[model samples]
Structures are given as structure tokens and as C-alpha cells.
Target: MTIAGSDSGGGAGIQADLRTFAFHCVHGASVLTCITAQNTQGVTRVDAMSPEAVTAQFEAVMIDMRVGAIKTGMLLNQEIIKTVAKKLVAFGCGNVVVDPVMVSRAGAQLLDDDAVKTIREQLIPLAAITTPNRYEAQILADMEIHTLEDMQTAAQKIYKLGARSVLVKGGGFTNELKGIDVWFDGDRLEVLQTEVIDTPHTHGTGCTLSAAIAANLALGKPHFQAVQDAKNYVTEALKYSLAIGQGQGPVGHFYPLLNRG
Candidate 1:
């Protein structure tokens, strides 16, 4: 299941997440925390759901569904963050893949300082694996990330927060360094790389990658293998990105289906 916001444009958030789960052959479920009036042009307004409503969704899923794993994206505020975290623990939901969604791929700030703090303190520690893009990693680690060494440091620091593993995504890097992700699990540091697909329609890449990781975990793949598979999936999706909107669009979640013919 994915606990995330809704993107009315259907490029990211719940739309991308469910599609990603489907591609992995997993039954997808969602608990929406916010609804955004957005398109490829950019996000305009966001309306967050009440914490009670959010918890109600969690209860419904936990009771009825045999959820193998879960991922979180675009948790709107501290109330929602704490609420989701509390319920996850109450129900003994493990294999939590946290996508620390504080910024957009275009470098827009999607979260406030208070919400960032809550994610760091409350949500991240509960993660089986936490995937933070370059900008989000910099914010969480309290350091500027410039080189690969910095990414390694950030991964280690984020792991110190109690996540069993950390994936510091480098897709934000342009030119030669693009599409490299740093993985660290307190003992070993590994870099996962993919050939960058040169395309403007790369929105929702972060959301899709994390959701893919969650789906792989649900299928019982181990930590490193899951992250690696998700990275490869995102890279391939980028190759088939759609040019649907006036601005940047989304990676193709059903690219494999396109290849199936």
C-alpha cells in the first residue's frame, strides 16, 4: 500500500504509486493525505485531509488487506505524519519504505520545516529503507551535497536515524553524474547507476522509484536487491516518459506493458 497525496493530473502521488505497484504485479492500495490541483505546469494549491480521515483509511486497509509492505510520499503536515506513524506501529506494519518527499524534481519545496522535522524524527526511523533525492538528502543530513563523497556521507548520516538502509538518489545530478544513487547500510557503501535518459518528461520519478521498492519488498526481495530493482525500473520508465502536458510530464509506469507486445 502507498500512503500518499493525490495528484489530480495523474502523474505522481497516488496515481503513479498504484501504477507502479501494478507493474510489479502487486495489488495496490492507497491512503490519500492531500489532494493537489496540479499538472505538468506545476502545483497550484494543496488541500490536506484531516488526521482522523487519514487514520480511518489506515484502519480500513490494515483490517481488510494483507498488506505485504507500504510506502509513504508527500505526507502533508506534522499531524498527518505522526498519525500515520502511530497507526503503522499500532498494527505492526513493517517493511516501510519511506520516500522523504520534501522537494519536487524541479527543486520546488513541498514541505515546511516543521513537517521536515517530524519526518526525520517520527517517520524515517521506522523505515526499512528510506529513499531521499539529492535535495532532500542535503536537508535531512544538514549538509550540502556536491560530490559522490558527500552522498556517501549523507547516506551514512541518514542511516544513523534508524533506517536499516538509505538510498540517496542522484537523479537530480545533471550531465555525467546523473542517475547515480548512493546506497549505505552502516557497513557497506554501494553506488547504483543507470544510463540517464535525456528527456524533459521526468516528473514523478522519485515517487515511482520508492513505490517500486515497496512492491519488490512486498514480493519478499531483500533490501539491496529491492532498491536495485526499483532503480532499474525507474531508469527504464524514464526511457518511455510521456509528453502529455505543456510542461514536464511523467515517467511511463506501464513501459513494460508497452514492451510486452
Candidate 2:
């Protein structure tokens, strides 16, 4: 299941996540915390859902479905973050993958300090794996990430925040660091690299990667294996990224189906 916001543009948020789950052959369920009026051009408006509505969606899904794994994205505010974290614990949910969406790649803060603190203190610790992009990693680990070693250090530091593992994503990196992700479990620190697909249509990459990780976990792959497989999946998907919008588009989540002959 994906607990996230809605992207009306169909490039990210719940839309991208469900598409990713479908590609992995996992049944996708969702709890929408907010909605965005956006397209490739850019976001024009965002409306947050009430915490009660978020809880209702969670209750409805958790009762009927046997959610094998779960991923979270674009949780809009502190109230929603707290509500989701509380419910996850109450339901004894496991195999949680957290995509910390607090900061943009360009160093813009998406969530306020309170929400970020709630994510760090309340939500992320419940994650089986927490995936943070470069900027978000800096916030979580309290350090600037400028090199591979810094990424490794940040991954290790973030691991101490209680996630079973931390994946410091390199999507925002330039030069050779591009597409290089650092994974740090309590014991192992490893760098994961994949071929960089040179394309501007990478809008949903972060959401898609975390969703793929959750999907692989649902398929019973081990944590490290799941993260590795997800990286490969995202790399391949990027090869078929769509260039439809005036601005950045999205990875081709249905690439396999598109190539069926």
C-alpha cells in the first residue's frame, strides 16, 4: 500500500507509486494525505486533506487487504505525518519503506521544520528502509553532502535514527555521482551504481524507486536485494522516460507493457 499525496498530473505521488506496484505485480492500495494541481510545467496549487480523512482511508484499506508492503511519499504536513505514524503502529504494520520528501533537489524546503521533525522522530524510525534524496539526506543526517564519502557518512548517520537501513539517493548528483546511491545497514555500507540514463524526463524517479523497493519486498526479496533490484528497475525505466510535458515528464512505469509485441 502507498500512503501519499495525489498528483493529478499522473507523474508522481500515488499515481506513480501505484503504477510501480502494478509493474511489480503487487496489488496497490492508497491513502491520500493531500492533492496537488500540477503538471510537467509546475505545481500551481496544493490542498491538504484532513487528518481524519487520512485515518479513514487507512482504516478502510488495513481492514480488508493483506498489504504485503507499504511505502510513503509526499505526506503534506505534521498532522498528517503524526496521524499516519500512529496508525501504522496501531495496525502492527511492517515492511515500511519511507521516501522522505521534505526537501527538493534544488535545496528548497517542502515541509516545515515541525513536519520534518515529526518525520525524523515519529515516522522514519518505523521504516524497514528509508530512502532520502541528497538534500533530504543532508537534513536527516545534519551535514552537507558533496561527495561519495559524505553520502556514506550521511547514510550511516541516518541509520542511527532507527531505520533498519538508509539509502542516500544520488539522483540529484552531477558528474560521476549521478545515479549512484549509498546504502548503509547497521553493519554494511555499500555504494550502488547503475547506468545513468541521460534524460530530463525524470520527474517521478524518487517516488518510483521507493515504490519499486516496497514492491520487491512484497515479493519476498531480502532488504538489500530489494533495494538493488529496485535500482535496476528504475534505471531501466529511465531508458523509456516519457517526454510529453512542456517541462520534466516521468519515467515509463508501463514500459514493459508498451513494448509488448
Candidate 3:
């Protein structure tokens, strides 16, 4: 299940998550919490769906669909976060992937300052895995993360906060080095590194990665294996990204399908 907002540009958010799930050969389901008037350039406007509506969608999906795993993204406010968290626990869902989407690639704040505390306190502890980018890691852990060592420390700190596993993504780094995503499960830590492709078509990378992980989990892969496979999928998608709008475009989410074709 992909619980996120709709991206009118079809490059990020729910659109990208669904595309990533399809690429991974998993059935995709969504519960949209908001809608964004956005493009490759940036988000122009946002319309939040009412909490009642969000709950209705969740009920509709859960009652009819047999979801094996769930992924959440872009829940803008504390109300929405609390609502979703309650439903997850009520429904007894497993294999939950939480992508703490706090801000957009264009630097627009997607999550409110007040919502961060709610997410960290209420929602994160219930997740099977929580994926946070460097900036998000800093916010969630309340620290400065500038290096790989810092990422390791932050991952551990976050684990102590209640997450079963943590993946600290290093995509926001300004240095000209390979991208490294660190994963920690309290007892073990692994760095999944990939050559960073210098490209502007990476609009929905975080959403895509989390969705890919959900898809793999639904297919019954182990947590570490699912993360590794998702990382590889995102790497290929970025490598063959398509140039769309005037600003940062989107990765080639259909790369595998296109290759098959």
C-alpha cells in the first residue's frame, strides 16, 4: 500500500510510488492524503485531504484489499500522522515502511515542524523500517550529520527511539562522491553505496526507494535483502532517468519494463 499525496506532475509522491511498485512486479494500492499542484520546477500549491477522508480511504483499501506490506509518505500534519498510525495498529499491519518525507527536492516544507515530533514519537516506533534522508536524519535525531560516521551514529540514535531498523540515505550530500545509504538493525550496520549519477532527474527518489522496499517485502524477501534490492532498483532508475519538466525531472521508474519491451 502507498499512502501519500498525489503529484499532478506524476513524477513524485503517490505517482512515483505506484510506478516503482509496478516496476517491481507487485500490485500497488494507495491512500492519498493530499494533492499537490507541482512539476519538475517545484510545488506551487497543496490541498490537504481531511482526516476523515483519509481514514475512509484507508478503510476502503483495508477492508477489500489483501495488502502484504504498507508504505507511507508525505503525511503533512500531525493529525494525518496520528490517524494513519492508529489505523496501522488497529488493522494489525506488518512490513510497514515509513519514509519520513519532511521536505521536497525544491526545498518546500512538506511536513510541518509540529508534525515531526508526532511522527518520531507516534508513528516511527511502529514501523518495520524507517527510511530518512540526511536532512531528515538530522531533524529526527536532533543532531548534525556531516559524515558517514555521523550517519552511523544517527542511525543508532534513531533505533533507540523505537524503530526496528533504520536506513539513513545520503542523497542530499553536496560533495562529488558516491551516494551511500546506511542501514542499522541495532546489532548490525551495512552501508549500501552506489555511484551517484549527476543528473537533475531525481525528483521522487525517496518515495521510490521506500515503495520498492515495500514491494520486495510483500514478495517475502528479508529486510536486508529487500533494502539491497530496492537500492539497486533506484540506482538503475536514476541511471536511465528521463528529462521531463524544466527543473528536476523524474527517474525512469519503468526502466525494467522498458528493458523487457
Candidate 4:
């Protein structure tokens, strides 16, 4: 299940998650927590759904479907976070991928600051893996992350904060280096690095990546292998990205279609 806000631009959030899951040939399900009037330029408005509505949607999905894995993004407030956390435990959901989507690609705050503490304390512990981009990692770990070493350190710190595993993404750092992601699973540290594609069409990268990981997990791949494969998928998606809007466009989610051409 993809628990996220709806992006009207179709470049990120629930839209991106569904496309990524479809690209991986897995069934995609969604429970929207909020809706945004947004485009490539930025978010103009946000409408958070009622907590009751959120709970009802989750229950409706859970009662009827067998979701092998679940991914969450852009749950805006403290109440929503607590609601989601409680429902996940109640449903006995496993293989949860929590993409701590604190901000939009345009640097707008998607989640409230008050919700951060609740997320870290309540939601992170239940996740199989939590994917946080550089800025989000800094926000969660309360430190600056500049290099791969910093990412590794941040991953460890987040793990100590109750996450079963952490994947610290390097997409937002201004280092002009390769895109590096660090993973810590409480026992060992592993770094997955890829050449950064110089493309402005990377609007939904974090959402897509985490959803891809969830899809791979549902397909029964191991945690490390799932992350690696998802990274590769995102790299190719970036390479084949299409220039869609005036601002940051979207990655070509179905890159395999291009290979067939």
C-alpha cells in the first residue's frame, strides 16, 4: 500500500509510487492522507484529509487486500502519523518502507515540524526500512550530512532511534559527486553508490525509490538486494527522464519501454 498525498502534477507522491510499483510489475494500492495542488514549479495549496477519513481508507484497503509490503509518504500532521502507526500495528503489517517525506522537491515543508518527533518515536521503529534524503536525514538525526561518511553516521543514529534499518539518500547534497546511499541494519553498514545523472527531471525520486523498494520486497527479494535493485531502477529512470513541465520534470518511470524501442 502507498500511504501518501496526491500530487496533481503526477510527478510525485501517490502518483509516483503507483507508477514505480507498476514499473516493477507489482500491484499498486494507495491510501491518500492529503491532497496538494502542485506542479513542477512548487506546491500552491495543501488539503489534509480528516483523521477519520484516513483511518477508514486504510481499513477499507486492509480488510480486502493482502498487501505484501507497504510504503508511506507525506503524512502531514502528528495526528495522521499516530493514526497510521496504530493502524499498521493493528493490521500486523510487515515489510514497511517509510519514506520520511519532510519536504517537497521545491523545498516546501510537506510534513509539520511537530509531527517529526512523533514519526521518529512512533513510526520509525515499525519500519523494515526508512528512506530519507539528505535534508530529511539531517532533520531526523539532528546533524549535518555532507559526505558518504556523514550518511553512514546518520544511518547509524537513526537506527539507534528505533528504525530496524535506515537508508540515507545522498541526492540533495551539493558535493557534485556520485549519488551515494548508505544503509545500516543495526549490525553492518553498506554503501550503494551511483553516478548522479545531470537532469532536472528528478521531481519524484525519493517517492519512486522507496516504492520500488517496497515492490521488490513484495516480490520476495532480500532487504539489501531490494535496495540495490531499486537504486539501479531509479538511476535508469533518471537517465531516461522526460522534460515535462517548466520546472523540474519527472523521471521516465517506464525506462524499460525505451529499451524495447
* Candidate number with greatest lDDT: 2
Q: Clashing pairs in model 4? A: none
Better of 2 and 4 by lDDT: 2
**C-alpha root-mean-square deviation, each candidate:** 1.0, 0.8, 1.3, 1.4
- Top candidate by TM-score: 2
Candidate 1 clashing pairs, residues 3+ apart or interchain: none
What TM-score against the true fold does each predicted structure earn?
A: 0.98, 0.98, 0.96, 0.96
Which digits, one per residue and each the tens of the lDDT, describe model 4 over residues 142-239? 89877677888899999988888899887876675348788999887998788789887888899999999999999999998999999999999999
Q: What's model 2's overall lDDT?
A: 0.94
lDDT of 3 by residue, 150-260 (tens): 999999999888889999988888764248888999899988888778887888899999999999999999999999999999989998898987888899988877788
**Residue-by-residue lDDT tens digits, candidate 1, 1-261:** 999999999999999999999999999999999999999988899999999999999999889989999999999898999999999899988899999999765577778889899999999999999999889999889899989999999999999998999999988887556888899988779988878888999989989999999999999999999998998899899999999979989998898988998
TM value for model 4: 0.96
Report every candidate's CA lDDT. Answer: 0.92, 0.94, 0.89, 0.89
* Clash counts for the predictions, in order: 0, 0, 0, 0
Model 2 TM-score, 2 decimals: 0.98
Model 2, position 90: C-alpha lDDT score: 99
What is the number of residue pairs that collide in model 3?
A: 0
> Stretches of candidate 2 above 4 Å error?
none
